[model samples]
Target: MAIKNVVVAGGSGALGTPIVNELVKSGFNVTVLSREGSTTTQPAGTTVKHVDYKSVDSLKAAIAGQDAVVSVLGSFAIPEQIPLAQAAFAPGSTIKRFIPSEFGVNTRKTPGSAIGKILGAKTQLVDFLTEEANKNPNFKWTGISNGHFFDWGLSRGLFGLDREKRTAKIYDSGNERFQASNLPFVAKAVSAVLQKADTPDDKTANQYFEIASFTPTQNEVLAAAEELTGGDKWTVNRVSSAEVQKVAEDKLSKGDYSVFVDLLSVWQYADGAGHAPNLADPALGNNILGLGHQDVKESVAAWLKE
Candidate 1:
């Protein structure tokens, strides 16, 4: 069934807003369910229904005629998705696709590893969705595991380069390739997936799709920053990928959960020379979902204020 009349939970959030906008732009009938006291306005022309998120019946009422429910809820509200999922695939519900908030690193890749344990909540949700999809013949779940948010990372210095600080942290030659997606690319990718729901040759019923805007090295990103900020104006800090874990582990021993990000960075920047878990090619999903590609410098430009 081609997905239409879609429902987006947490449609007012950072990632959620863009996904909602793109779905509406792609001509999908978009409905954003706001909480009872939400004062934020959704995108123009979107149908906003304020409902009880705690009650499954209220969720069912809002999701009654929808074809898909894309949950972009933040970390704190993840548990609420159980009720949303229950309402989506209920015995006679119209929803055929349920997409969990999986826009970060591949959580399904490592459940036994440290980062996997830290992200257990997210992976568990996917597991639940999978079981539900198996139980219901008409229902299926889709997961998009894009590595990182490229533009956001650049702007916020998550990839180890602070634009305002005029410094770049170079990790082990700084040329290890990691795939990532920007807000726009991720949004359009979701829209495309929903639009192509269960088509003959482009079936997206129960597939977990991996995608990225571009797979660029840190060196490429640094080059873009250096170019945008004049001839290598930024100070560079050289660091060994091998030493990253010790520092992360030390922090983890202190009960700092923020170390999870450090551990994830270890895999993305250091493990197998940056190719950890060694999964198959992501091009298959990108091709199927029509994500195409973009230049990394373009993304760097936005963050560098160039």
Candidate 2:
């Protein structure tokens, strides 16, 4: 099936915007379903549709006739999986494929650790889609596990680095390497997956697709930054994984969900302990996606320029 038309829920947000832009650049007709009165700009050749997440009918109408739906919508209060499933399986709908807001770790396989607790809600979303796919043969879903957001984390200071201060607090030896993907790389992966929606033999349904750039350690990232900046102007501090996990557990015990989630992400890959099992898929990792090791120094240089 040729997926020419795509609908992106929460397309106005930070991550979704890039995905939508990439899809548009790839010649896919894109539509963005956002909250009513949303002021976010839509990429050229993409339409913005107003649809409330809570309204099944609104969502169904917005998703109608689309070959694929890419959802990056998230809310701390609500699990969006239900609405997404509803829209995909709406009565007489033609939606063939669905990509949930799974842009982090492999929550479905690893659900007991700190990352598990933080991403437990996302697991529920995945389970919802699993059941839906069982009930509807035409319904299929893909989960993108890209380890960490490489460029965004550095530029926006997401991984605890003060971009202005050029300082980062490291965990463990900072020598553990894990795969990371830039936001644009993530967007390209989504576009590739949508482009080949009919190849069910690929076993993409209810399956996790691991997408990554070069797997590098925290020390490596810091070194790249230093090399790019031409000095040791950045300060790197060390923290134990056990200490970070303890703090995450404490926050969860205190009902601070936001801090708990952040800590969970820290515990998942702080020491590069978590491995992407699905990177072995040649179709996803090599042939089809053609994802290769990206230069950290070059990536950081581009980010610093921006």
Candidate 3:
């Protein structure tokens, strides 16, 4: 079935905004489901519905008539998805596709050592949606796994990098290659998936559609950063991902829920280790999704300036 009308939950977010913009650009009728009292602005030609996220009836009303539903809600808000999905698959609903917030690693199949705890809600939601889709023929689900957010993550210090100081806690010799995607490319990939929603050979449905901007090792990323901002200005400290993981585990075991330690635990999978099993795959969704590559140097350079 052709997906024309799309509803996006959390369309006001950093990632959701771009996806909403791309959907509008792709000629889909866009609607954003925002909680009442939200003040975020949406793109032109987009309709914003302020509704109660807790109520299934409210969510159903917001989702009604949408051909596709995209949930870009934050990780913590994953429980909200259960009701949202139920409302989408409600009787007489027009929703055909559901894209949950599986925007990072293939957490369902390869939940990395540290990120697994973080991915609990998402993993459970995936199973819930998969079973829901199986029960409803008219409903299908697509999950986009782009590994880590490269440009945005770096800018936000998600990569253990202090962007301003040009200092990094390099993981495992800085040579472990893993998949990553730039923010805009992620939006483009989502647009591409919606565009192809009509085709019978759609590889995205009920599957984890994985894509990447470039798979680079920590050392490669450091080289790029150094080239952008001379080596003398940058400092690097090498540490084993396993060690970081051990520390993180110990902290968490002792009931320390510090964000830093949690992030370090998640980095264990990304840090040049074999923890992430699917990072080495070459047959990404880029070709089938008609996505062109963004120059890594250019992206990194731009991000550094930000």
Q: Which candidate number would show the highest lDDT if scored against the true structure?
A: 1
In angstroms, give how far residue 68 of model 3 lies from its true place: 0.4
Q: Which pairs, if any, clash in model 2?
A: none
Q: Compose the digit string of candidate 2's lDDT tens values, residues 187-277.
A: 8888878877766545556677777866677777777777777676688777887777787688787777667546644644566576633
Worst 10 residues of 3 by lDDT: 268-277
Higher-lDDT candidate of 2 and 3: 3
* Residue range with the least summed lDDT across 10 consecutive positions in model 2: 277-286
Residue-pair clashes per candidate, as listed? 0, 0, 2
Q: CA lDDT of 131 in candidate 2?
A: 87
**Residue-wise C-alpha lDDT for candidate 1, range 142-247, written one tens digit per residue:** 8887788877676666888887777888778777788788988889888888878866765577778778787777787888888988876688898877788788
Candidate 1 segments whose C-alpha is farther than 4 A from its true place: 253-255, 271-283
TM-score: the better of candidates 1 and 3: 1
Listed per candidate, the RMSD to the true structure in angstroms reads: 2.4, 2.4, 2.5
**Deviation in Å, model 1, residue 14 alpha carbon:** 1.3
Residue 82, model 1, lDDT: 84
- Global Cα lDDT for candidate 1: 0.81
Per-model TM values vs. the true structure: 0.92, 0.90, 0.91
lDDT of each: 0.81, 0.75, 0.78
